[model samples]
Structures are given as structure tokens and as C-alpha cells.
Target: MGASGSARPAPFLRIAQLLRDRVTSGMWSVGDQLPSRAALSAEFGVGDNVVRRAQEALIEEGLLEGRAGSGTFVRAPRERRVLRRTVSGTTSPAPAGFTGTWEARSIAKVPAGPETAFRLGIGDDGMCVLTTYEFFTDSRPVLLATSWEPMAVTGGSAVVLPEGGPLAGAGVITRMRHLGIAITRVVEVPRPIRLNRDQAHLLGLATGAQATFIERTHYADGRAVETADWVVPSELWDITYTIAAPPPGT
Candidate 1:
């Protein structure tokens, strides 16, 4: 169904809907390669903008993924990430197999700057401990993470953990959980960020590299517990999501 009596909805929405139907009906299965933009535009009778909009919407929904030189394709299904909101602030454990070896750079109790204050909802007087780690996957640097925790919660514990430890094993969320804080939800936001010199060295890229900036906030008992910023190179990884329709007839 579409707006009003129009069988052909808005071009991009129609494309999205049609693609969704095909995926739901199993016409396009996981890992199936999609036609090129030109082919899709010809088939849908739309311009590149419409097709681009359609592709971007599906990408945001985690259905289809686009590669630089490679065409769009159905992403392999992954575990459903149910967004849970709870009082005991906790974060989902790090994705398994993301750890190979890590280099611990520095851990210090630092002042919470403007960005940190806004993300953690801390006051000007509040201080946060910053922990920086260079995480490698398959013996290559994948992400450079800097975690910020309120001094009241993790001030002492922050400097205790060793550098380059297993992300899941030495993850802060797990540590917070043990301290009686249960993370009920995690908020993940990704954006394009300019990489600095230090970030470049950690990720094996040159200075001024473009990277995906990931910011995550962990919550427990309706309050933010921890926040982290991850700098990941554009060429190193792909993000996938699965979108599905309601099961058969309600």
C-alpha cells in the first residue's frame, strides 16, 4: 500500500518497498548481488537520485550494503540487536573475534571536555577518566577506542585494566556490570570524522585520513554510565543490519 490511490508511490519509496518485498519473499537472499545503479534506474524508471535515495534508506535499515567498487548486495543475516532501556546502565559486550592484539597507549584521569560533557551528561565540575587503546584485528589495527567514565564510578578502575586486552574480556561494560551497574541499553551513533595524526598511526593510515567515528553511550537505571569514541578507518570494515517484515499475516 502507498499514499492515496497511487499504485506507483514516490520513486524512492517505491523502490524501497519493492526491494523490501523481494527480500521478504526470498527473491533476493542473503549475499545476493544486486544489479548496478544504471540497471536499477532503468528498471524503476527513475533518475540516479531516486535510486541513490532508495539504496541509502536500505543501507540505513541494515538490509543492503554497498561496497566502493563492488555493487550493493544483501547482507548476511546477523543477530538482532534489541534496543533495551533499563536503569542499571550496561552496554552489549563487544563483538566476538574483534580482538587479536592491542597496544595500550595511555590511561589517565582527564578533565571532561565539552564533547565529553555533552555525551555523558556531566557537569562542568565533573571529571572523567580517559582510557585509550589500539585494537587490532587479524594483526592489523582496526579501531582506536577512547573510553570515558565518570570518576565517581570508574576513576580508579580505569587505570587498572591492562592495555590491548581482549575487548570482550576486558570490556568496560562487563566491568561496570560487576560493580552493580547493569546496562539496559546502548546508543550507537556513527558519523564521518577527520582523523588526526595519532589516530592515523594507530590505524596504519596516513594523517588526514577519513574515518567512521562511532560514539556509544551505556545507560543503567536511567543514567549514563559510560561513553566511548571509536575511530575506524573507512577501508577496514563493513557494517550490516537485517530488516524483516512482520511474520505472514500478523
Candidate 2:
């Protein structure tokens, strides 16, 4: 407590900030073991529990790592890749400096479930194509995505199969363009979620870890033709969007 009787910052937070400063200022090098909890507690005039809380916070932030049977150690900085979306309804690939590869498997003529139908604005009985994708960076899994498109939009066309034919691997906008469907706008909504068991296994993350859930829909002439959901591990990627302003005169 201070002389003025005002509330002080939580002990754990102050300790965490002190430790973070040491890390950022090069006082602690990568792979260096942090002082024991007892030492830190005595040095900071706090309880051991407070020291533990501070260390745990750093672990979650990827600044410190705990090794089983070994002491806590500083961790190497994480590489953050950006997923960039443009207002032209086009998505750019990861920046050149980022090294990652994506694998996708697609199924066609699948019946759209009720939720999928609702998002596509189609009948519940309509059939659609579905594709699942997993992305890896530096041999570490980081992203998972599932996409759906109504068959009524691309059935009997050269782009029927999202991963087959001449337009294979081409994005939805380009494939739809080849079929004369001009997508003018896309809507995206993002929320935080916990990684489920299967998603955790696929992305190599701990179950219940923090992640981002994004729902996206593509429109051509104000009609929904495609929809998708992306599961991205927050620790592995950063997302950015670019919106172009409307022209003058309304």
C-alpha cells in the first residue's frame, strides 16, 4: 500500500511487467532460465503465488516457456503472419517472407445442411460443394478452413470442382468470373473461440486454446453464392483487412 492509501497495481501484474522489461531489454536471453519463484518473490517482496502468476502470464504470451522437470526459460520470438483481404473482394496470399503451404480436399454434390443453406440463402434441400483446407508454416500447422458454394451457381460449368479442372486452386472470385458470375462484395465477421479437440489436433494447438473464428460470405448482384468459416490459431497468425472508400457524390 502507498502512503496516500490509493490502490496499487496487482503484485502479479507488476512482477509480470518487470519480467517483461528484462526480456525486452536483453537482460534475459532466449533459452535462459528465469530466476526461481522463491528468488523472484523475495526480490519483489511478494508471495510465491504472485511470482507463479506472473510467470504463467508470460508463458501464455509466448515470452516464457516451462519445461517439465526443468525450470522456466525464455522463449524465442514468434513469427506472426498476416492474412490480408482487400476491398476488391480479393484475398492476397501470405507475404513473401512467410513460408507456408496449404493442402485442401474438396467434395462436390453434398447436401447443404440447414445452417449452410441459411448462409447461402438457398433451400435446405439444395446441394453444394465443400472444401477443407489446412495450412502449415515452417512445418507447424496453423490454420484450418472449410468453404461451401451452392451447386446452383456453378453446376454443369467448367468450375464445378473447386480443386479440379483448369480453374483448380483458383480462388472463388476468379472461378466465378470464368463462369460469368461477377462477385462485387464480401462480408466478414470474426469472433473469438476456443479450439475444439479436433481443431486442436489438426492445428497442433492445445485444446481450449484461444483462436479466431471468421464467417465470410461472397455476393454477386446481392445474391449469396458462397460462404466459408476459417479457424485460425491466434498465436500463429495476425489478420488484417483493407477497405476502399466510396467515390464522391454518393
Query: In order, what lDDT does every prediction score?
Result: 0.66, 0.80
lDDT of 2: 0.80
* Count of steric clashes across candidates, in order: 11, 0
Write candidate 2's Cα lDDT for 1-250 as tens digits.
5377678888889999999999999999998999888999899999999898788678767788665547788977667778665545343222223357778888988899999999999988899999888877766567888989899998898888777888787778888889888888889899999888688657644456689998988899889988989897888778887777799987
Runs in model 2 lying further than 4 Å from the true structure: 1-77, 87-99
Instruction: For residues 1-250, write the lDDT of model 1, one tens digit per residue.
Output: 6467737567799898888888889999998988888898999888988887787667556677655446778865433222222323222233443435666554555777888888888875577766677765555556687777788776555323424333333566677766777777777788998677577545545455567787878888678877888776665566543334699989
Look at candidate 2 and tell me the lDDT of residue 206. 49
Q: CA RMSD for every model? A: 12.5, 6.8
Looking at model 1, residue 217 earns an lDDT score of: 87
